[model samples]
Every structure is written in C-alpha cells, then in structure tokens.
Target: MVGIVVVSHSRKAAEGIRDVATEMGGDARVEAVGGTGDGRIGTSPEPISRAIADAADGNGVVVLVDLGSAVMNAEIAIEEAELEEEVVLADAPVMEGALNAAVAAGAPDATVDSVRMAAEDAQRVKKFG
Candidate 1:
C-alpha cells in the first residue's frame, strides 16, 4: 500500500486533515506533519523528513501540501531523507487530495503513480453546483 503525508502550516490543520483522510483510508499509512519544532505556525524540513520516512513502507509516499513553503519544505524533506522509496508530491488540494489519495492507497493494487493521480484528480472535484 502506498503511504501519504499531509503538510500544512498549522499542526492542528495537518493532524485534522490526516484524521479525516485516515477515516477513509482504512489501514493506509498517512502521516500529518506541520509547524516548526517549537510548535510555531510554520513548516519545518526536519519533521517533514521524519514524517516522510515514517510514512514510507517500501511501497511509496504521496505528499499533499497546503501551499507555498509547505511545498518547498516537502521538497527539502524528500531530499534530506535520502529514501529509497519513490516519493512524489501531489499537486492537489490539501483536504480533498488527501482524502482521494488515502482511499486510493488503501487499494491492494495501488501504486505511487496511481495514488498521486488520485490525489491530483481532486483538482477536478466539484463541490457545489
């Protein structure tokens, strides 16, 4: 099964999103990482790297970011982790993409590309008519 990481500026938000995603993921490995070491509202590469490594299970990891520095930090974390597992950041909405990726990752046939694609597909989701 593919793993997932949800990144946000606020620790609460990241954990909240992970909670929601996990409810729909069903045993899928989803990690929530955000804020600085001191619990400030900011992104940190160290914790993000740790989350990436934690989420990895020799399958792959799909990261979902809230915005801006989150992406940069995720990139930095990816580089610093030096993981052998294929890790890719999904360019999708944080909440929606996390949900989609979580569900896809729970599938037995799920792959990194498939999970990432599912997350990116959230970009096309319609909320209201």
Candidate 2:
C-alpha cells in the first residue's frame, strides 16, 4: 500500500489534514508531520521524514508540505534518512494535493507515482495566474 506524509507548521493543521485523509483513505496508511521549529508555523524535516519512513514500509512515500520551511525540512529529512523507498514531494496546493493523495492511496493500484500524478493535477487546479 502507498503511504502519505502531510507536513504543516501547526500540529493542528497537519492533524486536521491527516484526519480528512484518513477518513477518505479508510484502511490506507496516512501520517502527519507537524510541530517543528518554533511551533508558530513550519515543520521540521526530521520528524516528517521519520513519519514518511514509517508509513512507507516497503512501498514508496509521498510527502505534502504546507509551506516553505516545511518543504525544506522535509527535503533535508529525506536526504538524512537515506530511505530506500522513493519519496515524492508534492508541489501542489496543500489541501487539494492532500485530498488527491488520499484518494490515490485508497485506489487499488495506488503507488507513489500515481499519488504524485494526482498531486500534480491538483496543483494545476490550484495554480493561479
């Protein structure tokens, strides 16, 4: 099964997103990464990466970040972990990307590539001129 890691500055945001994804995903694996740095806003990469690793198991991991630091941190964590599983970072808008990822995860043929595709599509939908 595919694994999802949602990263946000506030624990609440991450948790909330995770809750929505969990509801949509059913038994699929979905994890949250939050409360990093000052806790005001911005997640640390280490914990986020760890969460991804745990959720990934053998399958690859898909990471979705809320903003700047969260993205940087997640990237750093992924590098530090040296995880064997493929880790795809979603450049899509947080909410749409996360929802798409959740749906992809629940799909029978869900994979990191599929999730990434869904996230990219969501991002396109969210993009503004």
**Number of clashes recorded per candidate:** 0, 2
- Model 2 per-residue lDDT tens digits across residues 1-129: 888888888889888988987787777687887885566666776688678878877888888888878889888987887878788888887777888888888888888999878977885683567
What is candidate 1's TM-score against the reference? 0.97
TM-scores of all models?
A: 0.97, 0.88
Q: Write the per-residue lDDT of candidate 1 for residues 65-128, one digit (tens) a residue.
A: 9988999999999888888989999999999999999999988899999999999999999989
Clashing pairs in 1: none
Give the runs in model 2 whose Cα sits over 4 Å from its true position. Answer: 37-40, 126-129
Global lDDT for candidate 2? 0.81
Best by TM-score: 1
Cα-lDDT of candidate 1:
0.94
In candidate 1, which residue ranges exceed 4 Å CA deviation? none
RMSD of each candidate relative to the true structure: 0.7, 2.6
